[model samples]
Target: MKTSDRRTARRGAMEQAESGQAAPAMLWRYYAVAIMLVACFIVLVWRVIDLQVINHEFLRSQGDMRTVRVEPIQATRGKILDRNGEPLAVSAPVVTLWANPQEAQENDEGWRKLADLLGMQSDEMVKRLRRHKGKEFIYVQRQLSPETGRLAMDLKLQGLYAKREFKRYYPAGEVAAHIVGITDIDEKGQEGVELAFDQYLRGVNGSKKVLKDRRGYVIKDLSLLQDAQSGADLQLSIDLRLQYMAYRELKAAVEAHNAKSGSLVILDVRTGEVLAMVNQPSFNPNNRDSMNPSGLRNRAVTDLFEPGSTVKPLSIAAALKTGSFTTETRINTSPGFLRLNGQTIRDARDYGTLDLVSIITKSSNVGTSKVALKIGGEAVFETFYQAGFGQSSGIEFPGEAVGVLPNFTKWQPIRLATLSYGYGLSVTALQLAQSYMAIAADGVRRPVSLIRGGQQGVSPQQVMSPGISRHIREMLETVVLKGGTGTRAHVAEYRVAGKTGTTHKVGEHGYADDAYNAVFAGLAPVEKPRLAMAIVMNEPQGSEYYGGEVSAPVFARVVANALRLLNVAPDRAIPMVAGASGSDSKRNGG
Candidate 1:
C-alpha cells in the first residue's frame, strides 16, 4: 500500500469514532446549561416577589428600628410675674447630662472624662456605671451649669447625651418664697401660687421621630409627632416692692419681740388684690436643701388664732347693721367687769359710760359684753358669717385654714359675751384681712385675688348697709387713737383704723395664762382707705406681748412704707401725732 493512502484510511477511522462520542457529549452540555439558566431566572423572580409584596413592610420596619426613634421635645415653663412685671418664679432652659450604660462601657474612659467635667470623682462614676450594668439609660447629672454643659459637649464622650429641660429659678429668693412657692425637677409646681395655678404654668411636651447613631445620639429628624407649645405667662397681683417692705418690717418686729413666728398680709382695699404676703422664718425656694414644714407654710392663710378684740368692729358692724343701736347708743360699763352665767369678763379698768365709738376706742370687754347681750348671739354670729369667717376667702390657696365660728345655737351666755370680744371662735389672718376689706370697700365684700385681674366684680357677696359699714369704720378708728390699744399702729402720713388683739393661746386643755397671740388687723388712711393689712406675732416672749406692742407696730411700719411705694398721695394734711391723748387704756382687754 502507498503511505498517503494508509494515513488517510487511519484518519477516516479516527474521525468516525470522535464524531460518534462528541454528539452525545454536546447534547448533555446543552441540557445542563439550559437547566442552570432556568433555575437562576426562577430564583431571581422569587426574590423580587418576596421583597416587593410579601415582606416589604417587615424589612422597612427592621431598617427603621436600627436608625429612627421618637424623642421628646421639652417645653418651656411659664414665668410668674408680679403686678409690676417683676419676675418671681422663672423657668430657664437647662442642659441635663444622660448616658447609656452599655455604650459607655464600650468606652471605659468616656465616663471618667465625663466625671471630671461633671465635677464628680472618676471612681464614683465607675461604681455608678457598674451598678447600672444592665441599664440602657442613666442620668449623669440633672440641671447642669451652662459652662459645665458646654465643656461636656466639647468632650463628645461616648454614650453621653444632653437634653434641653426647664429649671425654675426665683429671683426674690426667700423674700417672696412663701407666695411664689417652689417647683420640682420636672418643673411641676409644689406650693403657693405655683401649685395653685400649675396647669397654667406647665406646658405640654411634644415629640418627634429622629434617626440616632449607635451611641444613641440623635442625628436626623424624621417627622414631628406633636408641636411644642410654650406655657402661658402668669401675672400675679403681688407687688414685689411692697412685698420687700412688708417682709422687712415683719422680720424686724418678729426678731425684736423674740416671737416664734410672724405673718403679714397687705391687700389693695379697692381691688381686693394681695399686694404683699410675708412670713418670718421663711425658706429660699431657689434651693431647698434644708427646709422646714413650719416655715414653708403661708401662715397668714394657714394658721388660725382667737382674734381677740379684732372682732369687736365686726360686732359693732352687726349692731349698726340690724339697727339694734345707733352711733349714739350707750353701754354702761362703769363696773369694769361683767359677771355672766358663772363667767366673769373684765376690762383693764372701768371705762364708765361709753357710746359705740368710745367702746371700740377703749376695747372695753364689759361694753362689748353688754352690746352682745342686747343684740343676741344670733345677730352677732350672722354678722361674722357674712364677713367670711368660718369659711374660705375664695383665694382657694392650697392648705388655707378656714377658721372656727360656732353657730349661735351652740353658744352659751358666757360664750356670747366672749364672742362679742373675739373669743369662743377662731379666724385666720387672711380671713381677718378680708373682713376689713368689706369695711374698706364701703360694705362691698371683695373677692380676694392672687392673680392679676382676678376680681370679677367689686360688689359684696354678703353685705351690711354702706351706712352701717361706715359707722363701724369710724368706731374702729378710735381703736387707733392714743387711748386705743392699737394707737402705735398710727401711720405718720395716713390715718389708720385698726383693732388690737391679745388672746391667751389656746392650749391643749384651755387658754394658757402666759402665752398669747398678738394680732392687729386694719385699713390705712381711714378715709377712702387704700390698703388693708393683718399682722400676727405668735407667742411673743419679750416683756411686751400685747398686740399694740408687737403686731400693731408691724402693721404701721409696713403700711406706711407700702403706701409710699405705691405713690399714694397723703390724704391728711397733718401727720398722725404719736402718743396723742384720746381714750387709750392702761392695759387693753379682749
Candidate 2:
C-alpha cells in the first residue's frame, strides 16, 4: 500500500507540470500565425492599388499593344453605266491574301502549298518572306475570287489572312475598253473615262479598331474610326449596242484591209452626245496581260490627219456664206487638174463643167480649189473655225487632240488652194465628226459630250445659215447616191449623206507617196439628220487605201445596224448604189 501510493503521487505531479508547458507553446503558435497572415494581406492590397490606380494606364497600354489593332475597311468603287443604265464597269468582290512574315517564316510546307495554289514558285515566296522578315505585314497574293480565297484560307497557313476588296470588271471587255477605260489592281482608274472621272469614281476608305488574340485572330470589333463613302455612279452617253456594232465592224475592217490602226465615232446630232467610240488594235480591259501602248490608245479623239476631200464641203459652204456662190454656182474643172505655184491638184477624171452640187458628188479637188480661190482665205478659215476645226472637241477626254488648222492669214496662193481642197491642215476624227455634226444639226454646233449629262447649259452655236446648211446637206446626200464617191457608205432604206477622204500621210520630207489615211464622215436620214459618224483607217495595205473602199463600207454596216437598233424610221426606199463604181481615188483628194 505504501509503494503504490508513492508511484501515483509522482505521476500526478509530472502530469500537472506538462499541462502548464503545453498551454504557453500553443499560445505562441497562434500569435505567430496571425502576424504572418496580416503581412500577406497588406502586400496583396498594395499590389492591387499599384495595378488599378498607380500604373493603370501603363499596364493597359502594354496589354493593348499585344491585342488591339487598327484595320482598314475597303470601300467599293462606283459603277460606270451606259446612258441606258447598262453597266460598263462594276466593282466585283474579291479577296487579297496577306501574311505576317515573321510568323509565316516557320511554316515551310504551308507556304509551299499556298504558293502552288497561287501559281507562284515556293522558293520565290520564301525569298519574299525573307526580304520582309522584320515586317509585320506583306501581300502574299492579291485579287482572288471568293471561292479561291476561301480555299486558300482553308489551308490555315501560319500568319496568313484574307482581306476583302473590290475589283473593277468590264462587261463589254475590249469593245468598250477605250471609252469606259480600266482600273488598276487597287481599283484606281487608269485610262479613258476612268482616268477622266477618277475623283468621282473613287471611294473613300474607312478604318476601325479591333481586338485580336495571340494567334492574330480577330476577337471583336472595338470601335469604328471612320465610315466609308461609296463613289458616285457615272452615266456615259454611249449606247453599248452601238458600241459593239461599231467595234465589231471596225475590227473586222482593219483586219480585212490589213490596216495599221483604225477608229470610229458616232454621235447624236441633236444632243451632241457620243453614241459610240471605237478603236482597233484595241486592248481588253479584262485581259491586262495583252495591254500595250498601241492598244491602249484612244485613237478616235487623239489621232490627227489631213481632212482631204472631207473638208471640201466646208469650203463650198464658206463660199456660199460669203454670198459669192450659190447651190446653182458653176465651176469649170477643165482637164480635171489645176496648177498653182508649181503644185498640181488633180481630180479623178475630167468633169469639165460642174455645178456646186456635182463638185461634191464627184469629190472634185479641181472644183473645190477654184471655189476656194474665189472665196479668199479668210472666208474658208472662218468657216473651218466655226465648224470646230483646230479646237478641242469640248468633251474633256484625256489626250484629246486639238488638230492643226493653219492660220489662213499666213496663207500664200498655193496654201489657200491646198487648204480649200483639204490640205495644209490637220483634224482629229472627233473634230471631223463634230464639223459634220454642225452640218447635220441644221448648222447648230453643239458641244460634244462623253458623259450622259455633261456639257450642261452650253448653247448651240449657229455655225452656218439654215438655208446654206440645208443645201449642203442635200449635196452630201448626193454623195451617197448613184455616181457618188461614197456610194459604199449608202445604207438601205436610209437617206445617207457623207464625204470620203483619202489623205497622204506626212513623211520625213513631205506627204508620203504610199502611206495614206482613209476616212469617211457622214450622217443619216437626210430629211431629219439624227446621227453623225466618222471612220478613219490608217495605212491600209494592198490596193484598198481609198476612203470609199476602206472606211465607207464599215460606216455603212455599223450605221445600218445602229439605225435599226435605235428604231430610227426608214426614210426612203433602198437605193441600188451598192454597185456604184470606182471609189474616190487617193490621187484625186479622195
Per-residue lDDT of candidate 1, residues 186-227 (tens digit)? 888899988988998888889999998876777999999998
Give the range where candidate 2 is weakest over 10 consecutive residues by summed lDDT. 577-586
Instruction: In angstroms, give how far residue 220 of model 2 lies from its true place.
Output: 2.4
TM-scores of the models, in the order given: 0.90, 0.90
Pick by lDDT: which candidate is best? Answer: 2
lDDT of 2 by residue, 1-590 (tens): 69999999999999999999899999999999999999999999998899999989988999999999998888788999999999999999999999998888554687888889889998888888889999999888888999999999888878898888988999999999999888889988789999999999898999999999887778899999998889999999999999988998999999999999999999999899999999989988888887897889899999888889899889999989999788988999999889988888888889899999999988998899899898899999999999999998899999999999888889988899888878888888899999999999889899999988747988778999888889999999888777888888888779888999898899999888999899999998788998999999999999888998898899889888898999998987656654446454545766
Clashing pairs in 1: 483-583, 483-584, 484-584
Instruction: Give all candidates' CA lDDT scores.
Output: 0.85, 0.89
True-structure lDDT of candidate 2: 0.89
Model 1 spans with C-alpha error above 4 angstroms: 1-61, 457-459, 573-587
Q: Candidate 2 — which residues are off by over 4 angstroms?
A: 1-44, 53-62, 574-586
- Evaluated at residue 119, the lDDT of candidate 2 is 95
- For the record, the alpha-carbon RMSD of candidate 2 to the native fold, in angstroms, is 5.8
Estimate the Cα RMSD of every predicted model relative to the unseen true structure: 4.5, 5.8
